[model samples]
Target: MWLTSKIKQLLMVMKPGVVTLNYPAERPPVPKNLRGQPVWDHQKCIGCGGCSDHCPSRCILTRDVCQELRVMLYDGSRCTYCGRCADICPEGAITMSNSFEIACDDKDDITTRLELFMMTCQRCGRCYEMEKSNAIDRINLKGFRYDNLEQRALVRTTSETFSPELLKESDNYKRPSDKE
Candidate 1:
């Protein structure tokens, strides 16, 4: 009986079928919804730090070097691919790609960088933010939309300019007399 079972198993194995992938030599097909790794579209990114803020593994880092510049850093080794960063991005900047073979000997090999130019407020002259940000969009401000240009430009004039009284009520607001 054992011999018969062995012969039947051997016959089944002889049939042509896929056993394993010939990886490295041949690339495997990636599924549509596979969340392998995160890829950043710098053109679409607004540097709002939304991805860094939503990253659960703390793999994303955001740094404001000054009012005019912002930097985004991503580390693959620390990432868990939770997809929170991609979801929270208002600009659709971060997207998951099918490139999961991220092994590397050096830790720095897994790092990704993005740089963004910040827009200084023309009204207050102190506040700085992404060229196209939620704050500008929230008030339904016209002429500040990212419609005409592929890259949104910083509006020298904003709704804040119309409401000086509102700015005065804020904590960051400073009177000219206070400067003395």
Candidate 2:
């Protein structure tokens, strides 16, 4: 029985080398659903903060509130690749790429930072305003921020008091001044 078990074990361990991967020589093909590392998709991302909100590890950080917040900061050491952030992203912006070779000697060197453009909601079919764009541009230019006003260019108080639902969602809604 001992001889038979040993033979079976050897056969199982060396069965024609069905595995294709050879370490230090070649790498195996990445599976489609394999969540290796987090990467931001600039165009597809809506900058909704969903991924940041859902991230269990809190490795992802963004400065832009909407359109400009598309920039992302990632700390590879802090990220456990839990896949929660990717799953919660509504726009499919966050995804896991097959980039596992992320060994780094310095901790700070492993941190990655990026900028992203914010998506906007429009009223008259015109691109409205972005919160962090002007501010970031100025900061990238100037030395300091003055009362965060530099970042306040994107704020809109909406002087028009009209209900947005009437203009946008309701097909039958006509301006109150207009009637049959």
Candidate 3:
């Protein structure tokens, strides 16, 4: 009877469990809508301060200092794995990836700054963000929407008689020869 009991215990021990995982060697399946790592699409980003605005921990920051357009920065360390940024991104420029590894030793390494040089707006007297301008132009480049410049601006580099629009369009709309 003891031998039979020992055999039964051995059979139970050999029985397989519900699930088994072979990680790294075999790629594990990722669930749908899995929020992993965050990805930034620079071109789509308008720097409108939407993503930075929604961050709960204030890890993301954007400053249009001196009207030089938006200078954006993101702190991955302070971020609490919340999808607020990815959800609030106006241009759909930010997305969460499937990578959870973010180990870092230095605290400063968490802070990431992405600086963009913008063409100043001559009208608003404030620099028209190139990022915004690019987004606008890309939105409508049919050579028809002349009023597209309404949203664009350029910082006055020098006090010239040229309107920012004229300067920009002069190349396309050339001046008539005064020879007549």
Instruction: Assess each prediction's global lDDT (C-alpha) against the native.
Output: 0.59, 0.51, 0.53
lDDT top scorer = 1
lDDT of 1 by residue, 61-133 (tens): 5544444665667877778987878877777788888888889898678778777776755664433233545
Worst 10 contiguous positions by lDDT, candidate 3: 139-148
Report model 2's TM-score to 2 decimal places: 0.49
Which whole-number lDDT from 0 to 100 does residue 149 have in model 3?
19
Q: Mind giving the per-residue lDDT tens digits that candidate 2 earns over 1-180?
A: 999999999999898867766775786677888778788777776544445544666566543323223345666787898887777666677788887777889966766555655433455221222243444222121111111121211111221223344223232423345556
Which parts of model 1 have CA positions greater than 4 angstroms off?
1-18, 121-180
Ranking by TM-score: 1, 3, 2
Better of 1 and 2 by TM-score: 1
What are the models' TM-scores?
0.57, 0.49, 0.51
State the lDDT at 22 in candidate 2: 77
Report the lDDT of model 2 for residue 54: 49
Query: TM-score for model 1?
Result: 0.57
Residues 30-61 of candidate 3: C-alpha lDDT, one tens digit per residue: 87677865777777775555565456676675
Question: Candidates 1 and 3: which is better by lDDT?
Answer: 1
| lDDT score of residue 27 within candidate 2 | 68
The CA lDDT at 97 in model 1 is 86
